[model samples]
Target: MKAIVKLVILLFCVTAFSQGQQHVEYKKVSNNLIKATYYFADNSNAIQSEGFFNDKNQLQGMWVSYDTEGNKTIIAYYDKGKKVGVWTYFKDDKINFVTYKDNKLIGVEEKALVVN
Candidate 1:
């Protein structure tokens, strides 16, 4: 009985600790812009990313992917953040684009358009 009680206590503590972690929040800056804040899941310092959202808060443009050091690796755009024009991929020679409507991709072309 004592062992079972101890195990229950341990499990409760673990669950509480886990729940205290995983922090994420988003704030609307305007009708079309939102700032998403992320935490380390351990309640550490938060990092922020800006996203463009439609009237329905659907993502339109976002900084997707990150470098090894956490720098933004891709700047993807959307009519709302739906991936409309060229998504500039940082690192190496890669370029991609996606066309979308209502947050659905209608067309995608990758590594095709290059700028000199």
Candidate 2:
């Protein structure tokens, strides 16, 4: 029937729009710098990370990662986007760390930094 076809088309449009909202946006900071601007499925502002860069377009320093739930998952320090220094992992109120340099793991430590 015409009513059923209209409903099906409406549902398809809604689904396509919902999936399209998951895409991430990256804005360039300079000729070599870029930052990822995150958004929720509903297109709400989530978080943003400042991406570092080198003269040759190589990346360096802290790169952050966040959970879909809008929580920070890691604070990863990098040399040319390679893991370096304290790399942190978070779950609930607990935080774990792994030290690295030039993409090589040097040490790891796990502890809960917060209690609530």
TM-score winner: 2
Predicted candidate 2: what Cα RMSD to the true structure?
Answer: 4.3
Query: Worst ten-residue run, lDDT, model 2?
Result: 47-56
What lDDT tens digits, residue by residue, belong to model 1 across residues 25-104? 77788775776666555435544344556666666665565443566667776665455655666555666565555556
RMSD of 1: 4.9
- Give a tens-digit lDDT track for model 2, residues 9-83: 999999998777755676776676666555556546665344566546566667777765667888887677677
> How much is 88 displaced in model 2, in angstroms?
1.0
lDDT against the true structure, per candidate, is 0.63, 0.73
Provide the TM-score for each candidate, comma-separated: 0.52, 0.63
Clashing pairs in 1: 60-80, 60-81, 61-81, 78-82
Off by over 4 Å in 1: 1-21, 46-49, 91-116
Worst 10 residues of 1 by lDDT: 42-51
